[model samples]
Target: MKKEFSGRVHFVGIGGIGMSALAQHLVHCGYAVSGSDRQVNEQTEKLQKIGVKVHYGHSEQNVKGACLVVRTSAVTPDNCEVAFAQKNNIPVLLREQLLGEIFDAFKQRIAVCGTHGKTTVTAMIHHVLERCGVSHTAFIGGEYNKSNYFFGENIVVAEACEYNRSFLNLHPTICLCLNVEYDHPDCYKNFADVQKAFSALFSQSEKVILPSELQKMCDKAVLFGKNGSVQAKNVHVGRGTTFSLYSDGVFACKCRLKVCGRHNVHNALAVFAVAKLLQLPLLQVSQALAIFCGVDRRWTLHPECKFNVVCDYAHHPTEIAEAVQTALSMCKGRVFCVFQPHTYSRTKAFWQQFVTCFDGAQEVIYLPIFAAREKPQKGVSSFRLAQLARQTGLNAKYFSTFGKTAQHLSKTVKANDTILLIGAGDVNNLTKFL
Candidate 1:
């Protein structure tokens, strides 16, 4: 916490997952907090219940009499409240900047950064640390159970995002990079640019933990993978995964995770490495991780009438592949995937990769792209992606509306079929109708 100004803070995009968590934390810290967003949702409703004044739409008056203003990456410079705050000579800070200030208050700060699985990894570490009775605070990117942020003391754990190099604003004594891959095409030019950002984040940390695949990039990093410092051996993947964790060629502990997917095993590997580095109680950490149901929208399962519906926030090509693979492993019958491309830039950038990602799905339905923080680009749409997917000989089709898609699925889907809704957007809401 910076002490220069009084604790009168205003958030620009308050309804966002990250922004709402930050608002709750500030209110818990005895600050006078208020915010404005374009729409009202469950997050905004929660903020209101917690005594944070929230405005539905952006307005110049929303920032009046605030000591400072915080904005998410999605908020543009031309936003009404942001522009008004600047005109009034008020201090305007990005959300990551304020998060860095909050992190500076703690001695042990852990930041989990990667192209995917940051939310799961952060939540896993938080759960383990909490079960071990470690005094810690966590700021997660997605809603975990009920809240996105947990309040504690002495330590802070947060999900570090790499879009626009925002993770650089964080101060992490221990940094965990799950895996570096090309993402956020709207920001980075190529894979090298993405790697450079992760390298910059690694440079700021006193200790770094990453997968074995990236060990060559950072020799000093504590690695975890097929042949890393910490390894998951004798792995079994079923309704869940069971594996023996080894640290430096010695059997450390036997672990089981309720979460599905081989990707989650890799996520658990990173968490186990962190626990070992921190010297937390191994038995308790493993137990807590075993019962971890996972964060919202990360392979969350809803058992409908006869068929099953699984929701996942897999917007990237690699994540989509892993998600489909996980669905295939869990489904007893055919796998039906309803995918919504998150942004136009990403769909355009990873077009070729996206074409082959649905290889494991029996049927693929394309919903309209969810344009988050970006305008539609020329020659970029879900229809084109659907056509490309068909070129790869996958059973793919494009539906312009969710209602029509739902109606079609209701008639075509049968018992024992698993419907996987994959995206980082509102596609998860479709599960309610299904």
Candidate 2:
């Protein structure tokens, strides 16, 4: 074991997708890992199965023997375990700090960051690299093929999140930014604040990959959109999308994806750019893109349902708009959206956009806002959002609870009609009831 990780390393919010991946990685690295969460979920169960002690609730007693404590930004300083660690003189590190340390240990590091598509793009890079027989580890923000932590060596691929500017901790050999938009209103003052953080990451990276629209942000970056060095042409969206991949106007390969949406075409193009930089064959990478099953909760389709039910992790207005439009294009019948707005701050920040993002849906049903790490604000509620949509002449309703939402869907959703359970919260839990 490394001297730095000699004792039990503790995680305060280990149930989080990002935190669990790190905790599992430490366990594989032969470190004694322990953690606590407010509730038990898949992640906590996985850790317990691997012999890592997991407490169901937080308490100061949980961090007793820890050499170092790790916590997500959401885990406030006043958290009992965090406060205890600080008072005891045990060093506490933010989740990003530990992730940065692990990233630096690898020879080739690829960090994917954006307001949207970080998880999907990171998973795509991992998928192609694995198919090409590259030995590398990946820390995906969400599960891909039932796991978030892929164990390997030499190279590391990670989803670098911009929330709280946590991604700044990473200094990557290669950094890919899908698109930059104003998000995390709780953390960033405005769009410029968001761009400055991304610009800083691009500045430190040995090689930078960005969409054509973001070219002016980083002079050294290899662009990957329309008119970019890596571009996709003739995009046809059907079962998924089929497009032509080009590098600097030179035809690279004909690509077909199993994942739906034009957003995914952009994501795959980013992967192609990264693979080209690594000197991987375009043909092999193209084949991998075709067979790549998308990450969970990212357009995850359920065949067992009476009607088409797709679950997505799109909480922002931009992402929600894209997801709804993609569903509208693919569905044979009317499309319905059951959206649960994620946080109070985000809902309030993008109030006008959210009101119109569901314009194309046959009927839009919203549940109460999922207040993550914040108390409810006075003016922001799913009810008001529904009222706004109705004012614009769209069919919209707000249900106070998941049970009521599911009950309404059961009565209204018909065969061939597509239902999108959209949000980054516990909306997926409603799937079982449906």
In model 2, where do residues sit more than 4 Å from their true spots? Answer: 1-3
lDDT of 2 at 180: 98
For model 1 the local lDDT of residue 212 reads 84
Tens digit of per-residue lDDT, candidate 2, span 55-119:
98989999998999999988999999999999999999999999988988888989999999999
- List the candidates' TM-scores in order: 0.98, 0.98
Find the candidate with the highest lDDT and give its number: 2
Clashing pairs in 1: none
- Model 1 residue runs over 4 Å out of place are 304-306
Tens-place lDDT per residue, model 1, 352-416, is: 88778888788999998899989989898889888988887989999998788888899988888
The clash count for each model shown is 0, 0
Residue 133 displacement in candidate 1 (angstroms): 0.7
Which residue pairs clash in candidate 2?
none
